[model samples]
Target chain A: MLSELDLSAIYLTLKLASLTTLTLLIISPPLAWWLARSKLFFRPFIESLVALPLVLPPTVLGFYLLLSFSPDSYFGAFWIQLTGSGLAFSFAGLLIASVIYSLPFVVQPLQSAFVNLDKNYLEVASTLGFSPIKTFYKVVFPMTLPSFIIAGALGFAHTIGEFGVVLMIGGNIPGETQVLSITLFDHVETLQYEQAHLLSISLLIFSMSLLILIYGVLQKRQKRLNDA
Target chain B: MPNNMLKFTLCKAGLFNFAAEINLAGVCGVFGDSGAGKTSLVRALIGLDEQFIGSVNFNNNVWQDDKHFVKTEHRQIGMVFQEPRLFPHLDALGNLTLAHNKRSLYTIETLAKLLDFENLLDKKTIALSGGQKQRIAIARAILTAPQLLIMDEPLSSLDAHSRALLLPFIKRLAKQIPILYITHSMQELFYLANNMLLINDGKIEAVGDPQKLFIDPRLSLVKHAHSGLLLNVTCLSWDETHAMLQGKVDGQAIYLAMDKPVEQEILQIKVESKDVIIATQQFPHSSLQNCFTSEVEQIEQISASHILLTLNLGKQKLLAKITAKSLQQLQLKVGQSVYSYIKAVSIIGEIT
Candidate 1:
């Protein structure tokens, strides 16, 4: 049912989503924790910057990323000198764009979780002789498992369904940067109704199943807490 | 002065400003009203609140001074919060092992037995009741092998039956480590705390045995509920025949019709002031078993209708709250000899 271009698009999309989700999970926790806990004067400014992707047009963000990754720019030139390849129109460039676009989806949930955490747990943990970092890993992190899962799922799904940002920054290389959304769009433009319908149905099913799984787990956890 | 005792002087602008040199040898009760900053003192003492300018020295090791401050983890202090701050993500066993120090006196097995919650070891902390969670929390704190244990109203969240159940375990644990107990409950104070520091408005108002503070008229404003005399007594003999225990306080004999034997030798007894009756002459025909001649050492009026007669029974002190009519009828005065009658069951509190 699928051609070579379609299969490559699926693989590239999955790779992008997986990499974006993994990188965001590692990068978001400390940033979110700081956003939740720090009292610095610039905290709100940093918070707004993190949340900008949530409200700003994805095309606008992608335009900025495209500009920054161009060969003419300092950062883009550094990337080229180090890696022997230009960042623009590459899978690496697409990955960076997806991460930035999906930043808030990963961060906001984790930030709220950290803010809602009972500080007495940390205090008593310290009194019980657990160091601060050990306390976070052992007690604080486990307690917020539901939020972590929700953040990860949202970030992964959002990256998979991404369109505008990739269109602006990724430049649609057939096997490298052209993801499923671009492929579906290409099928529609060429009047390939069957392929377009297939890709659309698959994306719908994937998104629906991920959402159902996340909500089901969250509801089960809520019921358990209420029963407890 | 042992080096093991904790002494601190903390100064903050608005929230807390207090200083006290505490001899942490026994259950040192931090007794105060709701806004007395007892919790702040605990936070500063444990190094949780570092904004205060102060020095906290324990075992001659400076925890906080002008130049240095030890973090909470290295302080070797265990804390039981007002609520059981147990990890909801972990089972009782897991929570206890989270901060397990290898050199501690207890393992998960022994700590479960110590707190009398062996059946709850495998249960999730969120599934446990308040009392059960508190028991696990205490065991978890003890498993860390802290040099000092700080319990901030650990029983306040529990029901009366639960309080009665967990109090003995707390009493037992106090013998192993010096505890800094913070509570407004007079029952917990009278039962658990021997040495006490009374806090008032972020200051050390008084520091002494709870017994003395209970009767000090100045404390009537704060602890009018605790109108009683505390006596140190020993269970001299247990008469299984009469279902009674022969107790001695200040070398004077006293009898208790207790169904269970007092397991410990020394017992702290509370005789309420209102329960004692004062008579100018001894009643030989009275059915009361605790009638003794005592000399009135002082007299203070506690209220418009009642007078507090402080009586010396041999070397031990006793207080009798009598009506103004009774005082007028008996014409009582200081240094006068009178008979004090207390019902056998009136020793309502006895702590080992």
Candidate 2:
């Protein structure tokens, strides 16, 4: 039911979400692991910082991201120096914003999973001659795989449904930056009711199918684990 | 030889303070009450506690000293936690092979056989019962073939039947490596410990043979109601005619109703002080199988209502806990001769 324009927006949205989720999967674990185990005085402060996006208005975060992505700002200048292009109004800028906005969704689940992990398993592994890094790879990571999957799926879904952050930083560049959420907004704004209905239905179906697939796989794994 | 021992002296900011220098030659039992620093000491020894100032020299290597801090993996130690601590994501076999050292003599199959849960190797740890998981935990630790094995109250969480099933395997493991066995239970010490260290209020109270440590009146273990004396015994012969298995304690003959033949000649027996009855005169036709005449060595008031009499039976000593009223009625006195009556079945555990 999607037109060629609508299809391009869907592809761009998937690309941004995929890139953001993959990057987050790599970046969030170490931060989440530290949050789970750190006893430093700044732990709570850092935790609140990571969780700020959960409570802050999307536009508020988008406004700050917009400022940072402006070529005049140091962060934006450094990116241009490295990549030979300004960051604002680009797909790259939207990717960065989506990552920061979806960070808590990726981190909190993994953090709690690590926190609830029984430390004795690591101790026993250590005494058995498994190095710390090896134990994490073989024991800790595998044990918490379900949580990691859930975190990744949540980050991906959150990034796909993101609008305000993408809108502010990306500035409605049709081929380069406009995503599915922005496209649907454009359709509704133009009173193209039929196109809006198709876009809305597709996004709804996509998000619901993703959640169902992830949660369904998790349930089967949990049942198998319980049975075994 | 001077540095071939586990020596550590640590002073912590709070929680626990301990210092001990002892050879890890056999089963060195760590005995203590709950929160008495037994766990803290073991954790320090294993390099799990970094908040302590200390030097731990193992086999002449500086594990933790003024200049070096070796990690637990490099220490060649295998640890069994009070809980199984198995990886929930792994099956029993996976756990056994998680850190399998190539130098290990005991295969996973062999350990599973010893633990008597061979059928469970393919099962996920989450599906196993506590006892079953603990059995796998023990087998998993053994498969690592560590230089020193530490077990912290491994049997405490297990049921009595599981404890019984596992006790023999523990005693068997003692022969394979220098073991550090930590337990608050006096009875468990008798099963595995060759030498014992008593910890109380963040200090080492005593260090000696388990039998000697148990009998030391100053130990916190003696104050407990379950306190008892452990003795080494040898099976002399089986009196098949009377369905009695004869054993000896300090060359003195004792009879027990042992239906199955004991595998080892040398065994350890725990005799609770309350189970021994004192009689002034010996009776030939008494119902009790053990009636040994012995001199009263010392007397201590255990509680307001109880008098603990230490009896010297030949070269060995036995404790008899009787009421102050019974002491008065029997007129028991130090250096006086009296018959000590121990029933044939009162010995709850016999470890070989």
Model-by-model lDDT, in order?
Answer: 0.84, 0.83
Measured against the true structure, the TM-scores of the candidates, in listed sequence, are 0.88, 0.85
Q: If candidate 2 were superposed on the true structure by all CA atoms, what would the RMSD be?
A: 4.4
Residues B112-205, candidate 2: write the lDDT tens digits: 7777888988888777899999988887787788888899999888866677778767777777688899998766776677788889898887
In angstroms and one decimal each, the interface RMSD of every candidate reads: 1.2, 1.1
The segments of candidate 1 whose C-alpha lies over 4 angstroms from its true place after superposition are A222-228, B159-161, B217-226, B232-245, B256-270, B274-285, B292-316, B321-339, B343-352
Would you list the clashing residue pairs of candidate 2? none
What's the CA error at residue A186 for candidate 2, in Å? 2.5
lDDT of 2 by residue, A35-84 (tens): 99999999999999999999999999999998998889999999999999
Candidate 1, B135: how far from true, in Å?
A: 0.9
- In model 2, which regions exceed 4 Å deviation? B1-4, B13-15, B66-68, B159-161, B217-228, B250-252, B257-345, B350-352
> Highest lDDT among the candidates is held by which one?
1
Clashing pairs in 1: none
Instruction: Assess the local accuracy of residue B272 in candidate 2 as a C-alpha lDDT between 0 and 100.
Output: 79
Model 1 lDDT tens row, A156-211? 99999899999998877999999999999999999999999998998899889989
